[model samples]
Every structure is written in C-alpha cells, then in structure tokens.
Target: MVGAEQTLEVEGHPCVVVDRAAMQYRVVTSDSAAVALERKGTSFARRLGRRRNTVTVRALHELSLVVERGESLGIIGRNGSGKSTLMRLISGQERPTTGAVFASSTPIMLGVNAALMPDLSGHQNVVLGCLAMGMSWEQVNAKFSSIVELCGLEDSIYLPMKSYSSGMASRLRFAIAASIDPEILLVDEALNTGDAQFGDRSMKRMDQLREQAGCVFLVSHSLDTVIKMCSRVIWLDKGHLIMDGDPTETVQTYRDFTGHLAKGNNISAVRIRDEARASLQMTEVLTRGKSRRSRP
Candidate 1:
C-alpha cells in the first residue's frame, strides 16, 4: 500500500512552492564510539558485551524546512548544532531515523572532507570528481581549464592531492562541485578555507548557481559570511531550529544569545532562548493551521 504524504510548514511565511520542499529529520541518535567498535568486532578487550555502555547522541531534531529555486539559504549554528548533519541528510548520505526529506533533484555537497585520492594529482582528481558528479568525459575535458582557473590552483593542479594544503584541496573540491551546475548545492565550510580572492570567485559562482534557478544551502560558522551570501538564514541551537527568516535579524538574535552566554549571564541567555522558542512555537501553530485549512 502507498503511504501518506508527509508535509512540513515553516513558520508563517508565504507558502513557497518549493523546487525542494518539506524536509524533516526526526530525533536520531547513535551509539558511542566504544559501542560502535564492539559492534564492528574491532576489539573484545573490555568484554562488556551486551552490557556495554551505549550512550546515544542526537545530531538533529525535528528540522522542517523548504528550499526554493533561486534561493541561497544559509544554515548557521554553533559547532555540533547539526548543520553538517542536516546537509548530509539532504544529500542522501544519511537516512533519518524518522520523517523524510524530499528534493526535486540530487544535491551536490562540498565539504572540507570531500573525497579526493591522496595519491592522485589534483588534475586527475578533478577528472575523477567530475565523472563522479555525472559529467560526461567530454564535459570534464571541456571544463578542466575553467575549473583550474576558478580554483586558482594552476601550478598545484599538477601535484598530488597529498602535496596540497587543506585550503588548496578545498578550493579544488569546490571548483569541481560547482562546475557540474547541480540543481541543489550544499556547501559545508568550504568557502571559509579559501583565501580572499578565492572567496570572491566562489561567492560569484554561488550567485551564478542561484541565477540558474538552482538552490544553494551553505553551512558556516562565520555569521558574516552567512549574512553576506544568503538572502535567508536558519538558526539552529542544540539541533533545534530557533529561527528561519531574514538573515540580519536571525544573526543578531543568535549573536545576542551567544554574547550573553559567553559573559556568564545565564539568566539573560535563558530569557533570550525562551523568547525565541515561544516565537517559533507560535509560528508553528499558525503554519500548521494554515496547512490544515488548505488541505481537502
């Protein structure tokens, strides 16, 4: 039997007919590394067996979002706030323990850990990465020079990937990922690794992606980068989405909370968090009510 369609609404924003729509990830937890090693039969030294400690860590919780074409959406949060987890979910690298994610097309994700063969030269990796992204060999050949130029890695492209610094590798990866013109591009801290000139080129390429009727989801710890590149932003804390709206306002709210918390003003920080949560709850109610009314 066919299952019912699962839908999600974000706040009270106008019903955006998303090219990609209604993505949600339920609370998912994983066992600690020690338990994982035992499961993998790596070592039996501890011999805890069935009685082993198996603590679960939740990476993401109840995240519902819609992304439309021509939109550059920024995902911002403190470290461990589930930004990368959400991107992996959207990219089909990980399945949600509950709920579902829907997108009209496959998403290309460029991460700091993007795969490249350490033994292979940067040029060879580009050819391999492009082919992996579904480009024809001819297309790879055609895009090679432009990709090299975009990465500003003209000389290093001939060297083994192992010889390149982290920043250089990140630049080459970003260039390859952007060259294919993916319908949905998920960038995870890739831009921050590049130098100023490279950053400018990458941002322009992202703009080109948006202008081509594609969507870009950027996850970065740099609030300045998020505000500058994205028209809309989502603020996540402890895996919960506190706000998803205008970039400036959302960033400001996040900044205020972090500042108070850093200053050891626990009371003020808690108050700010409570207020944001209340606002989010009210928006959820309004959005759900509207969805119900619109349904048959």
Candidate 2:
C-alpha cells in the first residue's frame, strides 16, 4: 500500500483522477551541498561520514492527491511549508525529486512576482508573456485590449514594468494569465495584491473559469481568502498534510493548532497533532458513481 493517498471530488462528480504510489526523496542542505570538495584519497571515507550528517530539508514526503475539474482547491500552510514548491511541480516548472505528477492539461501559475521583463513596457510584456505561454500572435493581438482593461493599467501600460509598483505587476500578470482561461490554474497570493474592486472582478472571472470545467489550485496565507474562494481545503504543516475536508472544518482545525502554539501550550498542540495524524485518510481508490464512469 502507498504511504499516503487521497481522493478528490468536484461537486458530485470526479472529473480529474490521480492515483500515485508513495514518493520519497532527500534534498541536500545548501551549506553542506555547496561546500568545496576538499577530501583527499586518504580522507575519502572520513569525508563520506561527514557528508551523511548534512542538514537536509524535505519539501514534501510521500504526497499523493487528486484534483478534479470544476473545483477550486485551496492549500494553506505557514512559511517553509512547501506550498510554492508543490505549485512549481504541478506547473511543470520543476520535477519532483521522487515520484511523478500527472495532469490533464498544462497548468498556468499566477505568481506574486511575475517573470515579466523589468526593461520592457507593460504593453510589450503582455504580448511577450502571452506568447511565451503559447498564445499565438494573432490571439494576443485580439485579446490585448481586454487584457489591458482587465488590468486597469490604461496609459500606464505603456510604461516599463520596472516603473510599476509590485501590486501593479501582480495585477498585470494575473490579468494576462486569467485571459488564457487555462484548464489548470495555480494561484499563489496574487489575489491579495489587488484592490477590493479588482478582487471582486477577479473572483467573478475565477468562478466563470470553474463553471467552464477548469480546475484551480490556490495557495494563500490568508485563511479567509481560502474559505471564501475554495469549496475544499487542505492543511499542510511541516510538509505533511494534516487534514483534508470541508473548508470550514479543516481551516478551523488548522487554526486551533496555530492558536495552541501561539499560547505556548505544548500539551494541547501535541494532542491536536496526534489526533490529526490519527484521522489522516491517505489511501483511497476512486470508483464509478452515478455522475461519471470510473477509470481503469
């Protein structure tokens, strides 16, 4: 049996299927892995022993999950909890150190810091970014006006991206990515960067994207945002999934864990952690239901 596994459902149907075996891998610490090689022949064995004690970090261990179409999935965790790393893996920007990630379509990532060129105007960057994402020149031209309007950049769109504030850059990037209406969208803290008006519009767009059978993964530090936007939420702590269920219950449990830690209640924190682990339902097999046919 796999070390960890889970089933994903969207509405009453399962549109996306994921069944994976346990994945294990290690990452060498930066300090130790970057040390200059100074071991001579006589000290080789001694050096090897020292290397084994490297201060390594595990971004994720034995992770297995499924995400289906028409569901907006929220991932919440504190810093160093592997949220961005998981997004990178799903977007195909980085391969997992072990195991594999499969998707029905290419995932588009809307990051807090977009990869737009600082030297290029926002207008030029929009065209360039769309093209880089595989939109044809003609498509970019057709959508240029709508993209600019969605970003609300107006004449400022002519200015270089370097001149824009961080929020502006994030808005432009989100507008460009959302314009694509990708099948799998991965968002990382981009929503909080926009104003309330823009946030409302963006939320509407995301809703429309889901209505069209697309899947979205949002990684946010804002629990309120996750609860408001996602139908299902997963709590990940220290690179391990602590809970996965209805947004309200999972988020509350996560909040309780953090609250205990904040109050210096080690006993309560330990108790909560133990209970969460015991409730982990990691192994699941998807079968056919009234709404859809099962996969082989």
TM-score of 1: 0.81
lDDT of 2: 0.73
Best by TM-score: 1
Model 1, 51: alpha-carbon shift in Å?
4.1
Whole-model lDDT for model 1 versus the true structure?
A: 0.75
Over 29-54, each residue of candidate 2 has an lDDT whose tens digit, in order, gives 45643443423343666666774434
Candidate 2 residue-wise lDDT at 259: 93
Task: Report model 2's TM-score to 2 decimal places.
Answer: 0.80
Q: What local distance difference test score does each model get? A: 0.75, 0.73
C-alpha TM-score for every candidate: 0.81, 0.80
Please provide, for model 1 over 169-274, each residue's C-alpha lDDT reduced to its tens digit, 9 standing for 90 to 100.
8888888878877777788887776899998998888777756647788898889989988989987777777777899998999899999999999899879877
Off by over 4 Å in 1: 1-51, 290-296
